[model samples]
Target: MARRSLPSLRPTWRRRLTLALRGIGVLFVLGLIGLIVAVYIQKAQLPSFDELKSSPNGQMIRVHAADGTVIVSIGPSYGEWLPYDRIPAVMRDAMVAVEDRRFRSHIGVDPIGMMRAVKLAVANHGNEKRFQGASTITQQVARTIFLSNKYDLGRKSREALIALAMERKFSKDQILELYLNKVYFGGGAYGIDAASRKFFGHGADHLTLSEAAVIAGLVKAPSHYSPTADADAAVGRAGVVIQLMVETGKITPAQAASADLKRVALAPEPKQNSVRYFTDWALPQLDTLIDESSRPLEVWTTLDLNMQRAADAAIRANAPAGAQGALVSIDRDGAVRAMVGGTDYVTSNYNRATKAARQPGSSFKLFVYLAALEAGRKPEDTEVDEPITINGWTPHNDSRHNSGTMTLRTAFAYSVNTVAAKLGQQVGFGTVADMARRFGITTPINTYPSMVLGTSDVHLIDMTRAFASVGNKGVAVTPYGITKVTANGDTIYEMQVDRSHVLVAPYVAAQMTDLLQTAVNTGTGKAAQIGRPVAGKTGTTSSNKDGWFLGFSSGLTTGVWMGRDDAKPIPGLHGGTAPARAFAAFMKPATANRPIEPFETQVTLPEFQLEPDQEFGQPDNGGFVDENGNPIDQSAQPPTDQGDEGAQVDGDGNPLPPAGDGRVAKPEKLDQDWMDRVLGRDTPRNQPAPGRSPQRDRPAAAPPPERPADRFQDSRPTQ
Candidate 1:
């Protein structure tokens, strides 16, 4: 039957062909309608030319100094816009050759390039560059500025439509400029200029062929090809770009050879992100001030770049070997001028200045003394300096000597542990803790007797702020870094400059300043004196684990801390030694240009005497004698070193020469001449004679029966 009816197989074939043709026509019309609808939707969603030209696709926060110097840039960053003429010819050519070979010949979406990319992807087993497919430079620009990378058909269609529209609206040169200026080059950089500066430490106009190739190669997979992320991969990708440039006739083989990949060096970061310690502290503050956005922001900070450099250098120079150091500087207006979290920021990012809660040692005595003064205890009030046991805890002076009777001024200046502990008891420990809070110390302060001796751990920034309040004439100083934030050159948020209420009465602050001044002038903080009146305190923790010097001179206040991160004792470390020296080193340059302002009020300093006059025929028994006229045991007692253990002072507050051959014991291997070398100071303090060993045994304190640790063992050097 089938053989007989080969019947009109021709008609059946024709009917099938007609059905197929009709289906194809209907599909063609439907496709045409869908394409038109997509075009209209994408066009409606398209941004204006002005918006596309100026708006960034991501958020960027640029932190600036008071002088507008960029301290650091956070998130995606952009550099100055470069005109087409200013863009290096090699940069433009390299980008064209590697990213879109048919860039100039095509409208925007190059079919030939797409086909080539398809062939490559198939040959490579679908391992095309991440974030890069067959998109042309113009299409990439459209995607970057206009469309999301949703990996959907609609996104790609929109990208093509925008690219075509861009081609018609802008000249080829203008399109290329937009592409170069708006594309991401990774490492938080956007735009050719930003990427050029980020990679080569210069502008796009100064890009060499190698540098240009390196930047151009990053367009495929910015994060993967970023030189900062992987230098070798970036160089390899750059080599591919150079080869493409040669193959595309953008450069000859000889020119490719001249584009030395080995010469492509990435720019070093801003002092190895040393300022990150500052920016990390300041960036989170912005979230509270403004709504999140993709727009670029400029954060004007109170940071002084010069002061920051000086503080960093000082910490580096003065921090002892095997120890970490931190410094924070603030101005009278509570502006944070400089902050150094550690000696090297790259090694350890733990912000010791603001984050580390360390025992302030004798620095905590500021609050104790302030509380005492507020309790109506005059600085000249007298107290006996004998061994005192409070709650079964015997507190000894750092010197381990009972120097008869002394005024409160002399006691606080010398950081006498016995006297401070006694004062803490006389004025309630709770009141002392309350005083600390009033002075801006936010850490939980313990009301124990040892709290007066700084057993409570506190942040350096808080300690510095407390001292700043005193320097600010009792006006509470809330330490701040950001002054204002601006988006696209328009103000978004600005700090309302309001100094907090008075923390203490003006006269009380003046009295406290007088005591601090005496400490720096003739006591433990002597090393911090920078040829001017300095109101400061010296703090050395148990076994010299932590040494701190917080001082204010003129209108600037700075705090310096030095110790092991693990809280191990530093050999022969004292607050008056390295910490004070660093304070002086930093403050000298930090305040060099500022006007010198004398403290508004000065208390009449009483005559401080620790020993009887030689004319009285009092034997030089080292200022210690019992009521029975017998010489006290001096064996194994810690000698008064530079800090806290008061140096012999005349009635006029002048430091007397060392006793017994005048050879002071110095820390081993420390540069005694660092002040002369780094600060150009001619005056050299006590220098140990040649061949004298710096090592001196510090007798560990006999811990109290039930105490956790002997807080009475003076951390400061004793006479």
Candidate 2:
């Protein structure tokens, strides 16, 4: 009777729920099986353990100096394969303690370890929105040797399957050996043996327990934990690793405490010829010159080790304390033979020679003079060097004394700013900017009158390379660091440098070199004179912040700049002082053996009418104005003290040019440094800063009637 009366429950909600759960379980099982099959298929496409083991060695990048001597061996070099038994047991224990505690007991992929990693990842996710890794030694070996390091599920699954296959094929000890031998330990070290040598100055077999633990801790982040990078961080990480070993019973607590992290000493910083500056400059060229450096590569660079040594010595000797210096030397063909970016690359990695664009000051006179020459003016053309005002930015000569009504040659040789300004104005500032660009200057240039006196900042390498064209006799020399490139044990790319392209005609080069030669001989660049035929310019900024000596020897062109990185004035420093002396010091040895080349120029210059506001004739001294007799604005002037620092003109009979007197429009844009140092600008504020200097004062720019220094001293023009 009870069986007959039982209620039907076949279609109840509970039964329906049970059926749905069963369907989900089956789907989950099927999906897991499908994932496992897909992983196996992907694993088949990855490199096999044997194929990877026997792959070609991609070990060294040998950078050769100019004389074909290998100066730097840049990659990890492994001589012999380290067997598992040959490796110290302490190292193996330390690695196992930190990297994988259950490495011996678990299969290739440990689910427990993975779940623990996920938990930690969730708890400690600061800003990084992802899981940390729980890769066992076997999984690491799989990823390092047989698979690409990608984080997608497909790659991760393949990595797992490959690890499983690797575990099945090799013994536990064998897998451990492969991992220890192949894992990257940073500092270009690829294996345990190289890492041992790199950090401990010894082999892996001789590692102490402390060193082993310290090295083992590097598996997480080699660079961050490397003793070379930071000893305290390495010690802290090593301490954690030792604690893990103690908890795992690999070592006693007393043993862990006794382990001296200080025992891990850093290798000595190499004093050898690193050429880091040159290599750093050349690194960017690879993206355009070579497609990729996947295999072994060999590069022959343009570095001349001997010249580099000389340059370093020179920079050290001349650069003022607390001030920095940069030097760049280029051959006649535009090859950068030596580049000293700073006093020491170990102290500062900033490459001032290529990276900095400090104002050239009077050094920029060469372009303006050249532009004047291009505009039908000859070196023999007369220019009045006196107090002048143009567009409100008045520039003075390097010295208060100027050779009144001097020839254009003497004007450039002395770095006469007024004459340069007049010439720039006459030929148009755009013409001078174009001329500079023609010499390969890519930095943005302003068209203000101050640009004539090198208010425009320029790089040392660019200025040096530009001068190399004059040294090379008309052809524009393109600076290059790499001469040859080899990949996969074969010469894949050989540079056939096209030195035939002409940037300036031979006649123009000869004329420009001749003019520069006079500068070195009897001009402001007299400090750079090395006896033989040499041509260059000396430049000092308004505040004496940046000093420059850019010149060319018979065989080489070199540029030197001395200044503080903060743009503060170095007391009594000028282009004719430190930079010129350094140039002389470097060039004396660099050009000692080379033959002298004389500049031979044809004397032919066309005659052309001057610009609208122009003048072919000028008074000895006058208010600066254009050929149209228009009153030029000289509203912005330098500080009285700064104006007295560089070379400037002082004439006994300075005449004022007749100009149409009218209010001139203030320039919308000018050199910011000039604006900051000279005319104080009140922007987003009513008045200038408390310590700001006053606006341009024409009366203050005049020299004192009496000489402050002794007349008995050698009276060369200030630079």
Specify the highest-lDDT model's number.
1
- Model 1 residue 379 distance off true place after TM-score fit, in angstroms: 1.5
Model 1 lDDT tens row, 1-719: 55564544566788999999999999999998886676666657666666767787788778899899887777888888888899999999999998888889997788876676566655666465433367888898888887787764467767888887677667888888888999988877889999988888988889999999999999889999988889899999999999999999989999988777987777887656457788888888887888957778889998888889999999999888899999999988889999999988888998999999888878888999898888898887898877776665556554455776778887876677778879999999999999999888888887766677777789999999999999888899889999998888789898886775988888789889989987775456767867666799888766567888999988999999988999886765667778888898999989888887777644232333444221110111112222222223546545543333223332122344544556422221112232123223343345432333232111123111221011111122211
Which residue pairs collide in model 1, if any?
639-718, 640-718, 640-719
Local accuracy by lDDT, each model: 0.75, 0.70
lDDT of 2 at 1: 50
Which candidate leads the pack in TM-score?
1
Model 1 regions more than 4 Å off = 1-13, 33-51, 85-89, 104-132, 206-209, 228-231, 252-259, 264-270, 607-719
Among all windows of 10 consecutive residues in model 2, the one with the lowest summed lDDT is 704-713
Error of 2 at 116 (Å): 6.2
